[model samples]
Target: MSIAASSDAARATRRPVNANGVPIHTTSFIGTNWTNRTAESPPPPEPGSYYPMAFLVEQPPGSVVQSHFHAADQFQVVVAGGGHLGRHAVRPVTVHYTNAHTAYGPITAGEAGLHYFTLRNGYDPGARYVPQEAAALKAVPGRTPWQTTTAPVEPGPVIEGPARMEEMLEPRADGLGAWRHILPPHAALTGPDPAQGMGQFWVVTGGRLDGMPPLSLIFVNPQDAARTAMAGAEGAECLILQYPRRAADA
Candidate 1:
């Protein structure tokens, strides 16, 4: 499926805020069948804080995602057919939660990919997700690379290479940071080394995997980094959600 763009007509059609003080805005990207019960916004972090959580979701078949990692803790869950997780030996571990900070990839060899979602604890401007600096935490050796071109835009160092890991940081705000990952067939992605941040939470959104039932969800605590990975079989795709922590004053 093509990535949906925010349209001027859709923006013009935004409804006015109701009596509940919610800002009116057009919603897209989120699945059409899903309901929008709340407003979405970007977070504004103070100067230094640390909140970390994440969600992993599964998407429809035939999706593709480039290899990448973030500077926060991460997590994932299998929502569809079995896939591979990193370069390790392929196993039939379906619908299980894995921690952030370790490398993982799809396990299956077919065309079907696993869909999952993750949420990390990070900064947010009001209800909007944002990124901020942590306390005096030193960057993980060779792991804190940053990037600015991706969605949920932030101003951190850009990460490079296929063998890099994510860095952990403290949150400067209070709220949840959200992101989505689309993994394609026959692809491989690794996680940031755990010693960098906190942990993560994940959820599955679509597709079907071997060991995991449809729509299954799980959490990847900080200690389980070595066990996370996904692999797609024939004609499968996965959507993973990630939430990072935020500070109380953000």
Candidate 2:
């Protein structure tokens, strides 16, 4: 399908409520034809299934994200910055920039703390941030807490190049399928893309993504399951969160 046709399809399938019950909005790009996903939602979990959510976080110098854990596995892609992990005396470590799938954080350490992002797998139900007791973990002064990172899994060999789109079979064992896409400037993908199966959420990272004409975010319900489009101008890279098909339909 042409980029326009694909965007129209995406809009037709856009889900209204994110996992957290937040209302989602889809807008078009100003100069070019494109769509962007915006908003935040709580993580959803179902027995045997997994859900994927993406965020574009910005931490000021020395800021810190208190340690936290989750029932399901979590992954993070560091787009920028250098930081340390662990409690007490933070361990010096550099985040992975090239590889998006690399897992970090949720490590177990003695008395000393384990510094890292990305929730650990098989911990508890729902997304879990650090508890109040451990809130002391702070990003060292002069450095911002880990921020401006992309968690989209690297695209597969079949789909390569500037449009670095990756499809990963979320290892939830619950029959849940989740994937992330990182599109470069002027790059776009058509549906029925995976984002359609699970309602999608997007965050802009860098460069403006023009959402106009055929390029847009679409939502389609089962009744018609087609014919809807929402476009927006994404000034740079954006993040996307997609809920499971069952949850989205719910």
Candidate 3:
């Protein structure tokens, strides 16, 4: 489904819980694939099927997520607070990508805590912690296990500049890419065709999207037409994330 989710509207779905004695809040934005999901509960999707998942996670100060990897490719965008993903420090608007089976992170929240949105084009049962599940980890023939990080974008004029797009993760032949757009009030920007990638997620990081406030999320399916983001009166800043072609697509 090609639809938009307003940040305010998603607030109703917020569920607070404790993970290993740490307080955390998970808010669903695009799909219900996350609710009550566990490592063995949600059955895997049919081969070659497409599933999109998007949500925001808030971790209290000093919270930590042990090093792990998922069975599906995903992107983690740090939208607020401060933290360290392994050795690299992260703050607002930092984008991190990891192909399936690529292990990374022991994410530790700083004094301010950590808030990030996780986006995925495929369903992953849950994280597989290292060493323990290490025996289950096997490399896929053609799926390159890779990782990338984009520099953070500060507030204000940094996002109020002339309407233009900045490459975050350079576009690849496999359709893996990311871009940030800075648009003046009411300005319009069309995204890359979804046919070229697994799917696309339009995230409003600054200002508004069709009048929706920041944190708004729009998911465009591969079969749908390219989405055009219309800035709200206050202007806008957005992140366009495209998933790479999966083996099933071949």
Each candidate structure's TM-score, on Cα atoms with residue i matched to residue i, is 0.31, 0.33, 0.90
Off by over 4 Å in 1: 1-40, 44-49, 60-64, 88-110, 122-250
Q: Which prediction has more favorable lDDT, 1 or 3?
A: 3
Candidate 3, run of 10 with poorest lDDT: 41-50
Give each model's whole-structure lDDT. 0.31, 0.31, 0.83
For model 2, residues 1-250, the per-residue Cα lDDT tens digits are 2112233333443333222222223222111111123344233344223333222222333544444533333333333333443422222222211111122243223233222222122222333345542333242223223222233332122222455433433423222333344554356544234434433323233343445332222222223332322223332233332323333244
Best-fitting candidate, scored by TM-score:
3
Please state the error at residue 164 of candidate 2 in Å.
4.6
What TM-score does structure 1 among the candidates reach? 0.31
* Candidate number achieving the greatest lDDT relative to the actual structure: 3
TM-score pick, better of 1 and 2: 2
lDDT of 3: 0.83
Tell me how far candidate 1 lies from the true structure as C-alpha RMSD in angstroms: 16.6
> Could you tell me the lDDT of residue 193 within candidate 3?
92
Better of 1 and 3 by TM-score: 3
